[model samples]
Target: MNHYNLSSDLELVSMLKDGDLTAFTEIHRRYYGVLYSHAYKRLPDSEEVKDILQELFICIWNNRETINIGSNLPAYLYTSVRNRILNIFKHQKIESDYITSFLHFAHQNEPLADEPFRIKELVAIVEAEVSLLPPQMRLIFEMSRNSYLSHQEIADKLNISSLTVRKQINNSLKILRVKLGTHFFMLFF
Candidate 1:
């Protein structure tokens, strides 16, 4: 059995872009646990975390064409998961439920380690999917998501129309809904 290395994400991304599946597996092997745990922290429910990881990876594979990794893949992974989790908090109410799920900690020692990998895979998937959005869509997402701007604020700062801002936000949300599926059912209500 082989373990994974963070130093190799750049190499793996290269191979991944060249249509290599094994490289993805290798990347998955290295980071899935970290990502899964990240998601677990926000999601709390074990079952949903598992599905989220699958969606995350599927999103990555589906959107592998235009991702620019920029050398710090791990940081990118962490930020993406953090954003997604925060998005969950904003859309649904994960903070309280997340606390509730932790009530069974003592019996879950072994499973905890496996959780990170699951979250990280989804981070990878989200990064890939985010990259595939149109240039304006990506810009809107970054300003609102990465920079934590409001719709009105992003519109003013970007000097674009507010309708464009809402459209871009809606576009990103729709894509995420498709990408995340029933795993995010809590988000709608």
Candidate 2:
């Protein structure tokens, strides 16, 4: 182990390529702290930094036969850490952008969940006000608006003059407008 530690990086790489576990352990001991510090500078999370280093070392040991540091193991390790950190940042950005886009789409395209209840409430208020009108006027107003009958049509159905139907409908509208206010009147009628 002391001899492996004293050997140069090139000697360690050669021994590692032959599957020398001691050489691999020496390499890990020498490079882990430097690589961890390099990664932590860019990514402050302790667990994430540890995972990256762990994965990197595992990959090195698994692929030692084909690994090609070529006498610059420190540079290779640093580059690997940098690339991993950049990949993490890219993944986080994509997740952030997706969340932002989803929120925007929901806000623009989705109606409030309570919209039907609100419409029902508004209709109820308008109906309550309309029910307070004179009986004959309420019938005429309902025929003209709800049944989509013209004044002449309503007059023909009710055996009244078109002018009388028009007057009754107008009076009903005036009463509703006063009761419901101009805002609610316009929305319903």
Number of the top-ranking candidate, with TM-score as the measure: 2
> lDDT scores for all predictions?
0.60, 0.65
TM-score attained by model 2: 0.48
Residues 141-177, candidate 1: write the lDDT tens digits.
3452334566677777767788887786566556644
After TM-score superposition, the amount by which residue 36's alpha carbon in candidate 1 deviates from its true location, in angstroms, is: 1.3
Q: Where is model 1 more than 4 Å wrong at Cα?
A: 1-7, 93-189
Q: Over the stretch 1-189, how does candidate 2's per-residue lDDT look in tens digits?
A: 124434677777899999887677657655555566556766788999999989989999999999787765655666677778878877774455446666899888956479556545533443445444554644543552335556687677667798887676566446544654654345435
Top candidate when judged by lDDT against the true structure: 2
TM-score of each: 0.45, 0.48
